[model samples]
Target: MKFQRIGEHGAERPIVVDGEIAYDLAPLTGDIDGDFLASGGIEATALALARKRLSPITIEGLRVGAPIARPQAVWCVGLNYAAHAKESGAPLPDAPVLFFKTPNTVIGPFDDVLIPRGSAKTDWEVELAVVIGRRARYLDSVDEAMDHIAGYTISNDVSERAFQLEQSGGQWSKGKCCETFNPLGPALVPRDELDPGNLRLRSFVNGESRQDSSTADLIFDVAYVVWHLSQYAVLEPGDVVNTGTPEGVALSGRFPYLRAGDVVELEIEGIGSIRQTCRNAG
Candidate 1:
């Protein structure tokens, strides 16, 4: 099943997506958050639909927010794609390179992306984001890791090169945490609805294709990433994991950095698409 939250930025209402029709789910659940997913949110939504308990509502002009309510954390894996690593001139890591983007970076799929103050090399990364459905701590195996995922979403891991590489002492989080850096979803699609491992994801800037690749190229697939991270930290429900991106980012020095008014669109097959316009920070 697919789920979405539509309305103004902090005032979104949860709804279930059935093709182009959207059914309001507020009558059954408050919001699709960690507690809801961990305590049978999917099952509850299914039952509500089967019993014909929801009313289809119109979302003609409302904004679509990230599907899950603010996640506890937004974790990211870097250099997981061999070509992407090569493009960035970095060696392939032996394990998933983990990083964190504070939850504040999360923004609606179509929201405007702000180029942070003094930024010169803001870039885009199209990645498959994994939404955890259950707490995962020291997961026993890849199968166990897979079981903990609730669904998938598309994420544009917007970044700044100078802050990430030059001025911040090599800490990627410095560039990753700017407000609106992580534009996350149109919907959270249940794992059963699609296979996250084989989807094709791409990024475009101002209508020009920049990155084009598939999840099949991931060095550490979704299951292994969850299993690997769980050994060191507890991954709670509603946590977001950006699996990694493939090649063709602006950081390769092939394309220019984003500027105010640049439009960036990120799409991942099955999950959905996100289109964000870059603007200067006020």
Candidate 2:
């Protein structure tokens, strides 16, 4: 089942839409998560509610907001895809390469991605974001790990290569934490609705195709990634993990980085598409 946060221009609310029956979720509850993944989260409770009722609000009347209002944390994996690793000129780490992008970077779909000032190397990475449902710790197996996921969404891991490598002690966050860099949600689709291994991911700039690939190319798939990350950190509700991107980002291209006025669009087979316009900070 698919769900989204909806509303008119100024007021945004959540609604459960299963087929044609749209339920006014805001009248019943607050956010999508609570104790478990679905009971109060994006995965089940809302979906279960969506399939049953039709307390419809104007479908196109309100504005849409990020599926998850304020994510607990936005985590990212670098070089998880073989082609991406090669393009970025980094050797694939034996273990997942992790980084942090403060949750503040999270923004709604279609918002403009600001190219931070002095950012001479802004890059784009179209990644599949995994939303956690249950709080997990020391997960025993990949199968068990997979069970902890709530759903998925499309994310653009907008980056600034110069900050990452040259100015900031080689910290990934330096290049990754530019404001308006992370554009999330047209909507968050349940994991059951999407077969992760088979989905196709594509990115375009100003209508020109740049990155094109499949999750099938991920050297480390979703399940293993969750299982692996859990060994060290406690995975909490609303924590978002950006599974990583395929090749063809500007940093890895045979060209100068993004300047300004470039628009990026990313599509995943069933997860919906995300379009972001780039504007200079000046």
Candidate 3:
């Protein structure tokens, strides 16, 4: 099953998308958020839909917001893909390289992504985003880590190369936390519905293909990433983890940086896709 939030930003209504029909989730929950997920919302919603307890609603002209509400934290893994690491001139890490993007950077899937003011190196990264359902602390094994995940969605990990590298003072979040830097969703596919290890995730800038790679290339797979993170920080429900991007980003100097009016589209196998227009931040 797939879940979505549709309407204006911050005012979206929760929904369950089954094939072409969208069922209202308002009767069961107010939003697709941490509280809901932590309370078996996905299971309840599925059961309700199967019993025809949910009302089918029209979503013809509604805007699609991020699948989940703003999370308490947005964690990220850097260079988990070996080719991406090589392209960026970084050595493969023996362990996960972690960072955080301020939670407010999360935005609707189809919203406009702002190119930060005085920025000339804004780049795009398409990544598989994991949404945590259960609180995870010091998880014992990779096998156990799967139990804590709720679902997966796509994330456009937009960045300003200058701010991330030249001006970051060694902290990558400086470039990652800009408003609207993270465009997530269209829908979140439940963990059982898709295999995260081999999904195809790609990015296109202005109709041209940029990053095209599968999660199979990940040096550290999904389960290990979750297990590894748990050792250092508690993973709460609704917190998002972006599992790094593949090769072919602007940071490698292979393509031109994003400019205002450029359209960026990202898609992950099984989890649907998102498109965003680029505009200069005021």
Task: Judge candidate 3 at residue 264 and give its lDDT.
Answer: 96
- Judge candidate 1 at residue 84 and give its lDDT: 92
lDDT per residue, candidate 2, 1-282, as tens digits?
Answer: 566777542355766666665566765556554243545555445555646544665676455666766677888988988977898788987988999998888877787889998778898889989998777789989999878888888999998988988887857798888888888877778777788887899999888888889999888899998888899898887788999999888877665577688889999988789898889886
Model 1: worst 10 consecutive residues (lDDT sum): 166-175
Cα error, residue 230 of model 1, in Å, equals 0.6
By lDDT, the better pick of 1 and 2 is 1
For all candidates in order, the CA lDDT equals 0.92, 0.80, 0.95
Error of 1 at 92 (Å): 0.8
Off by over 4 Å in 2: 7-11, 20-22, 33-51
Candidate 2 weakest lDDT stretch, 10 residues = 34-43
Clash statistics: count for each candidate: 0, 10, 0
lDDT-sorted candidate list, best first: 3, 1, 2
